[model samples]
Target: VVKYGKWLVAAGAVGMNVLAARDHNRAEDVFGALEARCSDDPRLCDLGDGGAYLDPGTEALYQQSVGYDRRARRWLIGGETALLGAAAMFVWELTRKTHRPDNIPFEPEVRSLRNATGVGLRLSF
Candidate 1:
């Protein structure tokens, strides 16, 4: 059970790491696209007024991309948390001690009990 648990935890950690990497990559892609668009068009820059001007329909696309990037960031955080938890669990399971009766050095001894003499076992680690 311990071995299986460790394996599962390790797998979960790896999976979460992969997910986080993918999300990070996606966010980078979106940022790259935004940069590319801005570079390709000079008008995409901020105007002199407080309100910046964007191409027709381009503003909605940019907004949607930003929203997607934000969502990806959230997923990345979740994946990181999961990965950390799984890694800790894996370490805990791997480092846990198991008790084996055969491994213990138990010796038979004569002992005096209350109102009786009896044979007893003494254990030594």
Candidate 2:
């Protein structure tokens, strides 16, 4: 059970990390698209004291990119947490003591009755 739990946590960590990477990539793509759009239109690149002036559509796209970035950060945090859990489980398993019994030695006996001789092996569990 402990072994399985460790593996499960490790798998979850990997999954979360993968999701984070995918979201990060998506965020990059969206930001790149936004940049391309801004470069094509000078009006979209106008910067004021507050921030760059963005149209409604461009603003929505920027917000989408921000959302992706936020999601990526969340997944990364989750992945790190799962990875730590897995590491802790591994350490716990390593430090745990097993309840296995000690090895038992086998004894062989030879008996002779009448004109017959037989050998018998004995084992204790």
Candidate 3:
């Protein structure tokens, strides 16, 4: 169970990294497009008129992707944390020592010698 939890956490981290990288690339693509359209001076684009420098569709996609990335990151962190906690608990449970009831009966042995009999109790760890 602990091993599985570790794998789960690792997978989530990898997924989050991939998502972040993809979102960054998408955002960069939009910026590049805007820069090209504005002759490398995106700041000079019609800003006061509330004009969208980038294509409306692409901008919406970038915005949605960023929002999804943030949500995914938060969820991944939560999932990883939960999985690690569960792994710790599993390891602790497996390694912890517990007291058991002493239920073994003691056996006595009697041996007869040439002229005497001896009695002894047998015990084991």
lDDT of 3 by residue, 72-117 (tens): 5665566566557666766776797868658757777999999999
Model 1, span 27-77: residue lDDT tens: 667667767777888677444454544564446446666766676666667
As a whole number from 0 to 100, the lDDT of residue 91 in candidate 3 is: 76
Predicted structure with the largest TM-score when compared to the true one: 2
> Would you list the rank order by lDDT, best first?
2, 1, 3
Error of 3 at 53 (Å): 5.9
Local accuracy of candidate 2 as per-residue lDDT tens digits, 1-125: 77889999999999999999999999999999889988899687665576745576677778899999999999999999999999999999999997865675777889998989989999876
Candidate 3 structure, TM-score to reference: 0.42
Off by over 4 Å in 2: 47-52, 101-125
lDDT of every predicted structure (CA atoms):
0.66, 0.88, 0.62
Q: Where is model 1 poorest over a 10-residue stretch in terms of lDDT?
A: 45-54
As for candidate 1, its clashing pairs are: none
- Clashing pairs counted in every model: 0, 0, 0
Residue 105 displacement (Å), model 2: 8.4
